[model samples]
Target: MNPHTLHAPRAPGDIRQHPTGAARLGPELLLAVAAERLRAARPELAARADLTTPQGLLDARAALTADEEGDPAGSPLVVAVIGRFDLPRWVAETCRFALALPREPAATWRRAFTRTVFLAGRPDNLTERFTFDHMAEDGSTAWAGPAPQETTTALRRLLKTLDASRELSAWSPVTVEVPGAPPEGAARPPVHRDLCIATARVTVSQLLVQVNHLLVEAVLDQLIAPGDRLTLRAVPRLTGPAVPFAALRVDADPRRAHQLRAYAGLTEEI
Candidate 1:
């Protein structure tokens, strides 16, 4: 019943779209299109310091288009930049098209929509990892992540709930306690649990900014520095009752589990 063990070279439901002569595009072009669309949809996202900057975005696209790399699977480049706050429904939908990478255009689009919905309910402080697949000669590429049926449905429900919830103009701050800074005169407490904090109210936009900062810190701590070569595989794991979710396993060296642990920490939401 292990889900990650199975690798469907092709998803059973896949119905690929083959673009003819003029219609056919290179992988780089397809990625470029995806990136441009994302930029157009959310020009405001560009200014956020905590999230991937416009410069970082350009670098990712340049890497995708570069001819030097051999295997598409080997060069797992960052395609999309997600931060802590939730994305607008329209923007998230647009991103799906970008992630589709010119394959199964219809199905990939649908899957992207489903995935976006699933993400809506997740904690705002979640760290995101968006890697890209190289463009094949035919302009088709594999999905960035696995999509199991049960997980998809679960996400759909979660998205619906999130959509229905009233969006506040502001919310109480989300904070985590760390070891206390002891008073100079007092002996350092034996246990570090005691600390001082009060939640700060933040507007929706402010919340996104805060999350972006958290994401940046988390990635720096957990992920290998950007441009460090890496590899990935679909690792199946049971997420719920009879639900199979294909988790990604990334490594700088397959023989070393340390990097994998770091990758896991980076991708952990909240």
Candidate 2:
């Protein structure tokens, strides 16, 4: 299926009105504001030549206006700066909570955990529509069957893992109980559940990040014109003041994709 077909249509007058009037700044000034915000967010990183100094600003302006791709100047891109959330941390915490349960086998618990993370609060039919991977001892992998049960039970269990009443906006820290090491000279070794959980955490985190990147790419390539607007809202559960993560005026430059990939903190070549 064409991925573009999945995006919801943007409503009329959907553009966000910034109280500071920053949104109305010319592209050059807006990019400067965005760079300043990035610098403030990540003070330790070495400053980028395209973002930090006066000469850098001038160079960026020159590059933007060069119109190397021969596309006409269109509507100005309006990006909404949303504060960052620690999604990987949350995923790890949730996985720890699920893995600690003694009632189910690790595989069953993981299946339930995956469904709760990705499919909870959605249609039940979606569970059967999506397939997950199952690895074999011989290093082969095959498509796994749908989750054995509905996510309702798992969702309830996972929700209890965090206390939402104390502070609704922040992620509540979970206390994971680490299994003790096996006694010395034991005949059997300890179950490798910790390693399995660690692997699951990494897999889930990468998938979530890639899903986010795909959404951004779709918006850049298909949903909006060069001068149109895009706003990323903050994750509601993250505790912090909203801030611009990164901002760039969409243009015909081939490097635009790389800028976004960098903003996403993705290391792989796009």
Candidate 3:
């Protein structure tokens, strides 16, 4: 709890959990984890300055990526982890992907979507034991196929409501259904069949961004640090704010509790 202890090391704490069970991890927790992995990924910066806020995490990740890519260091990285993340499977995958990475983050504005996800399943129900088969050879993205129609519809609706309510700018250009592309003089199938929805799904993902905005990076930097490495399982909190750390267990896996315990190299009793 002291200020100078910013860079000090401590035992990894549980990152997810709440009274309601399967609840979403506190927004602060996400910022914390991102900070820890990101700082560790770039030890040079982690050793200095308190990046315990979401902005701090963003700044730290941006700095590291810029340093690696040979771009100017003064400015922040203008990148984002843009994709559909509200699906149950995606929710699990997003957390797992970023945390397990051995390299710097791909973007500075990384926002993991979970509106649809939270609407769909119990957050705690999401677990590390749920193995994600690799979809890409590089492993940057997961190989999860489309979820069941019920799941898909829920996501679609969630996205629509969030989008319409937010009235976010048309950052994305989307093509609905074209009227008549069949008869007249179409040499081939309509080349421009439908327009791509310009970040519609993405724009509506403010739920996550807003969630983290509360904690920012100041708190996050404390939870996650360079030397500390954690995975997807949720754990009980040893200390810190009620939330951000609440609803988030360090490792939130129930079925694989034994597997996780072994992996962390921790005994039941400490």
Candidate 4:
């Protein structure tokens, strides 16, 4: 058996205990949360989308988590949606729904789908550039990247600064629309239109900070439930968000997706 696919018996309403394996906890947990929000926000679309099924969500997660030997992020399902539907609206709504979930599951859902978005629909557009080295007092140009521990610490610090229950506001991907002329084979009354391109660029550290802030808030709100087999208490001075967190954008590449992998040392095909 593949080491990464190790299995652990799960309890009722519980997903799994380990991060590895075919029964890894993140995928279905994320699906249950996101699906709940999507069903409420867009019942008509949600009714038709494959995301309504656990297997469908598993397939979507598989698309994002596939190894290098597998297909690129541009999975057939993603291509189908992007080509035939209003991709921007879908992505915006999905992100909105993700923020509405409890922080842990919400973050997992966002990260997974964000990877899918970067790999499949927006590979050439999303970019990450690390810049912490420049913050050194000596101003020497060294490649001192942000450490994961340091990023987490910074996030915790920033979380204290955010007010509880930050309102859910309009936060959409930075988009560029390119207009195209009518096709040569177009019949009468055909409409020429624009392509909606979306992208985001934020350092891993910044993402960590945002995630940590939301996690703190989730804990304060007692977001975890009895069905999740977890108990949490609301802490004084740390009362978390009563509302959803807004999505934010970070700096990225204008044309290609190369700089981000180098800055973050990411190995994913995305």
lDDT computed for candidate 4: 0.26
* Candidate 4 per-residue lDDT over residues 113-199, each given as its tens digit: 322111112211111422222111122111121122233233233223212233222234343211223336533222111111111
Task: Give the distance in Å from residue 131's predicted Cα in candidate 3 to where it truly belongs.
Answer: 31
User: Which of 2 and 3 is ahead in TM-score?
Assistant: 3
Report the C-alpha displacement of residue 158, candidate 1, in angstroms: 5.9
Error in Å for residue 155 of model 1: 3.0
lDDT tens readout by residue for model 1, 167-263:
2343232323221233455332222110111112323332222222222222222222221221211122111111111112111212332111111
- Compared with the true structure, what per-residue lDDT tens digits does model 2 show for residues 74-173? 2111111112224433322222233233343433322121222232222222235433332122222112222333323333343222111222132232
Name the candidate, 2 or 4, with the larger TM-score value: 4
Ranking of candidates on lDDT, top first: 3, 2, 4, 1
Task: Provide the lowest-lDDT 10-residue window in model 4.
Answer: 261-270
State residue 103's C-alpha deviation in candidate 3, in Å.
13
Best lDDT goes to which candidate? 3
Taking the tens digit of each residue's C-alpha lDDT, what string does model 3 give over 227-265? 222222222222332222322212212243211110111
Candidates' TM-scores? Answer: 0.19, 0.19, 0.26, 0.20
